[model samples]
Target: MGASFFSFSFSMVSFSSLRSSLVPTRMMGVEGQWWRTSGNHWRAEGRDDRMRGENEEDSKLSLDFTSEEKMEIESIKTYKKDLLDDIQKLKMEIDSVMAEILSFESAEENKTIERNKQFSNGKKKFNMDPKKGINYLVEHKLLDKRAQSIAEFLYKEEGLNKTAIGEFLGEREELHLQTLKAFVELHEFSDLNLVQALRQFLWSFRLPGEAQKIDRMMEAFATRYCDCNAHVFQSTDTCYILSFAIIMLNTSLHNPNVKDKTTLERFISMNRGINNGEDLPEDLLSKLYESIRNEPFKIPEDDGNDLTHTFFNPDREGWLLKLGGRVKTWKRRWFILTDNCLYYFEFTTDKEPRGIIPLENLCVREVPHPRKPYCLELYNPNSQGQKIKACKTDTDGRVVEGKHQSYTICAASAEERDSWIEAIRASITKDPFYDLVSVRKKKVINQTPQD
Candidate 1:
């Protein structure tokens, strides 16, 4: 009985030990499950954050795309608006041309009715020859009227269509006819080719805007050359236009002083006298040559005394030598001598002036050139020694304060130097109001003592 009881106690102790080991194993399993759950939660949160960032980026891209679309729409609208404005302007021009055409047609109908009535009554007063009508229109300086008449005469009286005209005329004549047709059709503004042709026609006149009467006369002659004057010019006549251009240029030279001359004056001035339209005369040619040579120095006829009152004169251009700050350097500059100021540009015509020297309170003297052969010095006693911004120099600058500001300029030749000096002196001495006094003094000096 004692042995059995001891064995039972040992078994109970073994069972308790086994149960303690099983408890530790279960606790480790629970701790691993809790850690895995926490890791999964952290990973899910990171994924959510990534998705949110992607969504924000997508939204910004969409906004940028929307703005681009808006800008494109706005640009298209602006282009459309510009096109509409141009179309509107073209419509207005068309309306004005239509009005002119209506007025012209009404006047033509009235004249025609009157002529037909007179002819029907056996008066026999009307000449239906288009040539005579065109000649009269040209002589009257009715250019716009001539354009319509010539077009009608070509189309109706001659029964010449565009294709027929092209087949009948030479290549040059065909082109001229086509240009006239375009002008008659009044599509010149819309057609770029016709516009260029019209510009060429206007430029052939070689006169100012104020010369409207001359312009009209020239235009009439041009239209007549295509119509009534066709008898004078053959299909192969290339010299007609060239001869006319020469005659017009010669006329301008023959009488430069005549401001209000007629087309007849221009026609008479030609060596061939309008009938043949030849070159200029020897006297006129010589005069043109002389005027061109002296044009730069000549004072404008309308404003001869501008030098006494104005600060700038844009008509004259020439060359001069300017002394650099360095002792040995002299640069050639294109100088423009204005009324009260002198500006120097670069040697090229397109470049703007580099410096301006005011002639007011200025004194000029011929200086013996050390570096420059024929030099002159201009001094302004009132100026400070301030260096001109346009006068770029490397050595020392001229004094531009209290003392005189001196500018030394050179000339290519002695004659040029003398001319510049004389011009400067004349500019300084000119008194516009003293012209009457000078004339009176001259008259008194010429008068006899007995009087």
Candidate 2:
């Protein structure tokens, strides 16, 4: 009975172990099925959420990039506007500087003119006597005996007043154009003489702010004597316009300042405002410029005694090629023949002469140059001593010595060369005494009974 009970208990224990193992296997299969179903759904939902978050992040990054690009464009626009403002400011500053410079120059010129006028007035007040003035001029070598004789003749024979004689004598002493014009009018000068006088008056250094004076003078002269007179144009305004145009042309041609030069277009624009705000005919303007450029106003020959009375007056002045003595090179010089001296300057506007060649003993003759045409030479036949007088002075008032014995010059053309030669010869022989002597001889012959 005890063995049978032990066997049953052992079977019961084995059954219990087998059932425990089987129950664990069944529970594992059921849990695997549950995982396959619910776990897949949860994983799919998580993956969708991650993809949506990534898309939102990408959109946000794109929006940020666009905003950054817009900011960069606005920055460039702002920078460009700033640069333009700077350029505009710079232009305004430049214009202001230029205006100030012009104003200063004008003021300085006015001061100089005023000082000169005061000095002239003081001298005039001090020297009131005409005879004393004549004596003074003669003693100073400003007038030769011949010029004095002419002055006497004009006073005694021509019945000219002391004022006219003084004007003529003091022409070189800062005479005004208005005074000169009055003198010319009093003499009742012919048209040619009038033009010659005007030409001489115009051949001077231009002063700052003198354009208005020039314009007025030109207009007055044109109205009085030019073909564009008021009678020529039915409308007075038209005549004035024409006269203004002529004045503008004269200014452009005569002004020596290179910066003041104007082109045809600029010239037209300048006049457009004057012609009732209408543009002038291009062809007409062009033709005027061409004509003026080709045939400038020239001082005609004086067949009368107009030039004979004037002493130390400029006879011929123009550009010439001068042979340098030391450098052995050709340099352009402005030559002016006055009285018995041939003065040269580096520029036409130079107040001082570079050298002076006395025509008293010098003779000018055409000479053949190896490589130049229209050449002439001025030499002293009597001596080999220096012919050119040095004009440059040292601080101690000593004359610098760089003079040459001879001068070789070249002109632009044969006509110019011949003109210069004739002018120089005339100047050398020019003496009012010779004319007086000739007149006296003729009078003596006439007074003598015919044989």
Candidate 3:
């Protein structure tokens, strides 16, 4: 009952950890583009593109639905679906049991009468004192060090690991009602292995408990898939481990969006089965401890825009390509060019239609098209992809504003301000259209220009 919540600590920390644990989520492949239908296929950058719509969101299912379903998959759409489903089922069951208990409690006329009813009902609750339960388990030698660490934080000197909890919760609060409710339920029992009991309770509801099980599963998967040369069990900073599992979940046979947050929450909520609180119906932080052993994470959002696309730029990290003095990005050119700024791709006299053409900062991008560009765009040997212009940076690898909005033209150079225009014409000629070039780089970012 919210009334019995007298005076106890709440764990804002659990919520904080849950949020931080979401580090390194997953996402889709490149986006943006216009296309045309060719027979049953769609053509973009000149390649045979595949369809991703499982089977028309409203169409008849084929016998080979799974394979047909995999089309247009970013990377891990199916796996997330199943995982989330399992979690959802667990959550509902947990909710059912808690609701039953609360109903029985509420039926009583008074606090003592309610206690009597609960006792008669044979359902025990954990005592309100967190340290009592933790120390009880420790004295019985039932808890390992990690469990003890969790225990030490509970009912700690600061009336709950307020400092550490604050780091996780990111705020200070006297008591989180959700944590208090959980603590009150936990305090009524004496012989239970709190951690193990939590595990069994979660599984009863369909969630992961026992930090060991999640660690082992994650460790094994990481070695095979991520080649992560690290032991998950060795440390509590399991962000890397969780990130790896998420990658696997995304890469699994039946993955959904690896970054699907609802999918992640639903799966954990349903399968691991932490009973919902009568005092606290929502606020995921209440169930965080029960789910965090495997370091549960937040699924990444699907908003596709201004992404951090990584690439190696040969010219400079701050430099960018500008066309007519304006930066002409295909979809987004966040990645730096891996090759150097100015390179000469010379055409020899022996080569047909020969004229020495210099190629500098030619970047190959995914373009507005998702499918590969049509190869026909490069029918001529002298022809390169569409040339989007680029430029060098100032002292600190910063893109200069002067050239950002400028354009390049052959005749405009007579004014001295049209140097970029002059460069564009010189970059291409009889080739009809310039080829789209891609520069290699380390990686791109999903951030806006801060300064």
Candidate 4:
């Protein structure tokens, strides 16, 4: 049987009324099958496109990749195409259904067949123009009647007999529910599709919590964007949704001020030793510090050369985001630390990364949590000289009274970065009296790191 669909965007909502918390009441039904309103509430969701086509040659590139990577790339290339084709098929089917409705009837016909046997079964079903039928029902609301207990009365209304009303309502209800069902089902399909779409990206980038938050970021972006304001969250890998979200986030939501590039640079300059890597050159640490300190707010360029990009006021404005966590440290001897220090860099829209910051220069300060003592700390590897002092110095990190305490930390991954911004911003607006701009802050000093 052909089905009639309920056409509504995700944002489309109708309500009897909604009450806030202060207006308390307990009027919800206690026993009725809440779901029985219609066997038709669930509708099918969107499907993945069977065909994936990336206009970018790099998206389909097999060059500079290992055999294994190449195979994965090929698979993705194939899957994307398949997904694209699937969406086309659904679109075509919807068109066909719409065309069919041009001849479908909208209401009951009083003309009598009198059970006459011209076609065989003693009774013949009547056919009506789908379009006129739709117009009639829409204009009259003949097909959307709500029976309180739909299931108990399902197919039991004798008055609905021999009329187009029964056929129209019955089929429409199924479609309405089917549409909702399809709506949700599409997400499940997209879940796999998204993972597939990002398979290469995930393998290519060494991001923290890469897959974990891509879904949420795209979701928030979709909500932040869409002109239709559609809230229907389908699959997780919603780049399309994200495209919409960026538009929304930019145009509608309250925007936080671009952080101070100078302040950000001061913080990084004061604490620049954390990014030293074991794999990097023996002298890489010194150069890395010099590079990071020189231009703490610059983006790396790809012109076969490195320039001073960390400086605050470059010709171009961008963002510099740095995240790091402590792995291990030696003590009283080699890579020893008298205390622990954590740091995170919150940069201006123009801040960019010219080079990596060293671990010793790292200082992480958390935006105060609701009920906990907030912390800011700086880790200075050597107080005096670079050489390992042939002997131990002053009572080993002598206690400096009530000072900063270090805690294990995690940095936001590229995927979680946007979501983390959301989480952080939510806390910022929680206190009505707190205005970020009004608050006075100096080049805040992290309490000297204490063990």
lDDT of 3 by residue, 1-451 (tens): 6644532223445434433443222222223232222232322221113435535532422321245333433234454455557677989999999999888787755766755554333211112233343444445443332433443333332323222222222112323323322322333223332232222222211111122322332233223222222321222122222332233332231223224433455534432212211111334323433343343222212211111110111121212222223434422112121222222111222222111112333212111223322111101133344333434444464543333222221111222222222223233221111111100000111112222
User: What TM-scores do the predictions have?
Assistant: 0.26, 0.30, 0.14, 0.14
- Strongest candidate by lDDT: 2
Per-residue lDDT over 292-384 for candidate 4, one digit per residue giving the tens place of the 0 to 100 score? 335321111211111111111011212322222222321111111111211122333313222222233333334443322322222333352
* Of candidates 4 and 1, the better by TM-score: 1
Tens digit of per-residue lDDT, candidate 2, span 209-328: 122333344433433443322233233233345444443455466544324766777766654533233344677567666665555543223222122223212267899999977678
Better of 1 and 2 by TM-score: 2
Q: Report lDDT (CA) for all predictions.
A: 0.43, 0.51, 0.29, 0.28
- Model 1: residue 195 alpha-carbon error in angstroms: 46
Best by TM-score: 2
The local lDDT score (0 to 100) that residue 155 gets in candidate 4 is 30
Model 1 reaches what TM-score against the true structure?
A: 0.26
